[model samples]
Target: MQAAEWRESIRNKKILVLGLAKTGVSVVKHLQALGAIVTVNDFKPLDENKEAQSLIDENNARVVAGSHPVSLLDEDFAFMVKNPGIPYTNPMVVRALEIGLPVYTDVELADKMTDATIIGITGSNGKTTTTSLVGEMLSHASNLEGQSFVGGNIGIPSLDIASQASEADRLILELSSFQLMGASEFKPHIAAITNIYGAHLDYHGSMEEYISAKWRITANQTSEDYLILNADQKSVFGERQTNATIVPFSSTSQQIDGAWYDQATEKFMWHEEVVLDRRDLLLPGNHNVENMLVTMAVGKLLGVSNEDIKAGLAQFHGVKHRLQFVAEIDGRRFYNDSKATNNDATITALDSFMGPNDRVVWLAGGLDRGNTIDELGAHMDKVHAMVLSGESAEKFQALGQAKGITAIAKAEWIEDAVQKALDLSNEGDIILLSPASASWDQYPNFENRGDRYIKAIEALANPDSL
Candidate 1:
């Protein structure tokens, strides 16, 4: 729909926005501009929330703060615009659903405002890297009808991008299961599920629910659209049906009709043509090779040239906090894989850095989600020393001791962990921050934790600091 028609449809409609963050504030601004009567709600007190105060003072928004009172339902809201992170079981949300009021996330709203061809990517991991790679590949394509715009869970709000996006643009979105769960009419022209694994059980309450939420990305797709499925995890999905054409990508098998890595040639095969050689990639890990398979599928479908795809891969060096290389101090190299918030991700990080003789001073631990360290059992051999922190520090310490790691120490938090890790490292050792748990216990998010780690490393590397 055009902006005018969208505005007309929502004009004068009473909408309730749940949870106040940057995205929540954006939702309020857009709705208010469209003449919608928006009631902004957040758990933070009004005095403590600068966003709420500004909304009230600047836009005259109906600000409800300090709680998510179910009583707000008395206002007879037409529907709810919810922050993706807020669970559906929240009292207000549960009550709203009980009354049959429609609830949607800003991603749905963003979809309705733009005519751009959307490439939505989601997975248990590799979402950011694959989305970013596709964006770079398409950006290098000189013949594309549209420019590439990347957003969603990767950082920028989709609404902000959708508002400015034209028909001659492709919005490459990195979606989370949380964001996908709330998206109803948000179908992309091409959708990709990189892979699925057990994750976010706290939010979804179960692995089945988490997988279901991720599967929603393909729910609205038709034969006219394309769906990229990770061939390795085909068994997990088990003959699920979707109207969209399935483009299977694999790192271990040769796909005659889709995208795959040809083990014999050491090349990424896109429908029989070699798009890229694995050795040419700057990013490490087999997980990244899997990511590139998805990217190759998306690039091929979008008509990106092989040369441009190769160029994109050559220049890109992975995203921040996901196996990103920091400065080298003395002979020890530091890597920030702060985005590795789960065991599978951390295992991938460990596998990426493992070599014949390289020892890793592994800095890990964070919010305890009750995940088992069983998967890391075999990989623990590479950990020369372990500096743990956060809520999961004790759990990790126990695991380290169980694995017979001689150098196991706990720190108060990430900064302290970094210092202890530096002290434990040898001249040739790799200092890695690949926390196997979420950062919420000590930091607001993984990005803050990663920034702190980077800052600590930089501070230690300064010559004048001594």
Candidate 2:
């Protein structure tokens, strides 16, 4: 459908809002503000509804809680404003599309509302960290008028922020697969696809479809835009289908043209002129070093000075939920890495901090994405014991059994997993939650999973015993 036709059809029309989550609530508010009759739908009961009620009552949108049936949809509604978490292949969504109901996403709405320069970051992993770092770096370098806020897949509603963000001369956006699917014309001045690995396989159906979604960051880029990529990841840098000037960064080699790693001082050498020291990066990881290189290359492309880049790198405190330290007790360090939902991320988390002799009780498992956990075989020797939970618990147990290692893989819940981990942990040991699977099986998202893990660890490690 043409953009104008799509817009007019939804203009002041009845709309069905699916998934009353953060993004869903924001979409309801935006659509209602434009005088559309909105009805919020979810799989839970509406009675005593807390978050949904506040958003619905304020916007005068009706709430149909407790299961999503096609009957809940009013024929008068022109389109379905889908939450990114909901699959495009969902029976309800597919049926809606079949009936000529236009399915629009939050990104599509945000794209229509903003006129500011956008920098969207997408990948199978590292989107949140990279987006946050980019925003921080821009803040240090940019003397431009207006404000800059980072949001999209990371957190917050960019459209809502854009409407109120006067000081935002630029917006740093973290786009996800669902957000990118309906982004339509969402392009960024500086776009990067950090890395692609097997992820959200259930939602994507195939690896090819998943890769296509990540590339959506560069979907609408013109000749004037910058497309920075992880030179280490062939899934991104090796793609010859793109039109933007391919700037690459890698920790492995300095052979890439634009940004390459210096093995001596561990600095990111760019254009044979600028260098950003890896030591200056606050986030401690070889993965983060790669993340920093990508951001600095983008900064260099924008003519951001060395001092500003350094200042930005220093000020960046690192993203929460990715190896975020919760607390330590009895000399045991507990880390909440609920964000490590893929194989690469979990492996990076283990390699970043685990010591050779440290009794590492690794908490893993969740819905199996058909990912090859064999990739984690190298770190398997590093980890002392594995505590498995969620759908893939047995698979992990089998892996440990086959390898003849110590592991506990019977947890039905996060707390069970924590207790199992604690039972296996000793003084000077580290407890890490680096589940290599999506969190949707047991929690709202990875943040919820991480928060629960941190809370459970806090209860286990009582310092008042001091």
Candidate 3:
């Protein structure tokens, strides 16, 4: 759609901006600029909401704060632009859908406004890392015709970034299933599903629903577009759902048609050609190796040279909160992996430190989502001890007992958890905070949870401040 045509379509039309977060605020400003009559609706009270108050005071925009009353639909809105985090099961969203009003996340709006070639990435895990990898790779490439922009679920709201993007730019987005569920016509030139696992069951209701939402990244793509998938996922091969040409990546086999790790040569291979040496990568784990395979596929698909890809990979240590190394107090090395919000991520983190001498004092637990600890049992052999916390603490304690782990401690808060972990640990043991659950029980997001762990580590390092 032409930018002029898309803008004019919403002109003079009443649009509802649901949930006044960063994405909601950006959508409201863009809608207002497009001459649309925007009504910003948020569940936060008007006095408590700074974003809503700012819109009302500065731009004189219409807003309904405090509650998502179904009566808001009486305004005859053209469509509803919802915050990605707001589930469709939400009362207001359900009502909006029942009324046959079109609903979308900011992605759809961003896609309509920008002419940039969108490269969207989504999966159960590694979305942020792969998105950053592709973004970094493209940024280093001299062959690219224009600049690259990274946003979406990776912090920056896509609307403003899309608005600033020129036709020559590459918009690399790290999309969450929550965001993807609401995306309708948000097709990307290059769409990638890093891998799929059972996640967000509370929000999605079922594993099937969650996978369907993740696959929506390619809903509008045709044969012309590229869809990079994990070849390691045998189920994905059986469930081919996209028209886009599939580019598969794997950590197990080097013969994949897309990208793979050549064990014999000890190199990262794109199709058949080498991209980067495996030993050169500083990031730990086979999961990161899988991440690199996906990243290289994207870089190669964008016509980026192997040298440029290597340069980008070389510069990247790792993203914060994902297996980030903290201070080594005495002989105990602390690693913050507070971003592992699911069982699979925690499993990966546990498996990564399986050295004969590298015993793990695993710090875990957070918001309980009714997860069974059975799957985690197999990966706990290397975990010499466990420090549990949050809503899932008791559940994890059972796992600790079942596994016959020597040391199992529970703490009320993250700081206490860190101290408990330290108490359980001996010299040379790795203290890891790889909570296999979300942080919503005690913290707003994973970053906050990770930050708390880091702060606690600092406290342990400098006892004088205490």
In TM-score terms, which candidate is top? 1
Per-model TM values vs. the true structure: 0.80, 0.71, 0.78
Per-residue lDDT tens digits of candidate 3, residues 143-235?
989789999999889987898888899899989989899667889999989888788999999888888888899999999999998888967
Model 2 — which ten-residue stretch has the worst lDDT? 1-10
lDDT (Cα) of model 2: 0.76
Query: What is the per-residue lDDT of model 2 for residues 1-466, given as tens digits with 9 covering 90 to 100?
Result: 4333444555678788888678888888777766678888877677766767787666656888877788654466777878899888777788787787777788766665666677778887678888888888888885556667788888787667655553246777888887777555676778888888888878888887888877877777877888887766774434557667778777788566877778766767886765667656546566777678778887888778888888998767577788766776778777788888898788888787643465678888998887678778677766768888888888778777766776565788898888888788788888888898889888999989988887787777664643
lDDT of each: 0.87, 0.76, 0.87
What TM-score should be assigned to candidate 3?
Answer: 0.78
Residue pairs with backbone atoms closer than 3 Å in model 2 (clashes): 44-66, 146-167, 146-168, 147-167, 147-168
Ranked by lDDT from best down, the candidates are: 3, 1, 2
Model 2 RMSD in Å is: 6.6
Clashes of 3: 0
lDDT by residue (tens digit), candidate 1, 1-466: 6655876898899999999788898889988888889999899998899999999999999998998889889887889988999998899888988898889988888878788898999999889899999988888887788678898888888888887888889889989998888567778889999999898999999988888899899899999999999888888886578999999888887565799988778799988787888878767777788888998898889888889889887777678998987877888888999998999788988998665677899999899998787778788777879998888888888888888888988899777888898889899888889998999999999999999998888888894874
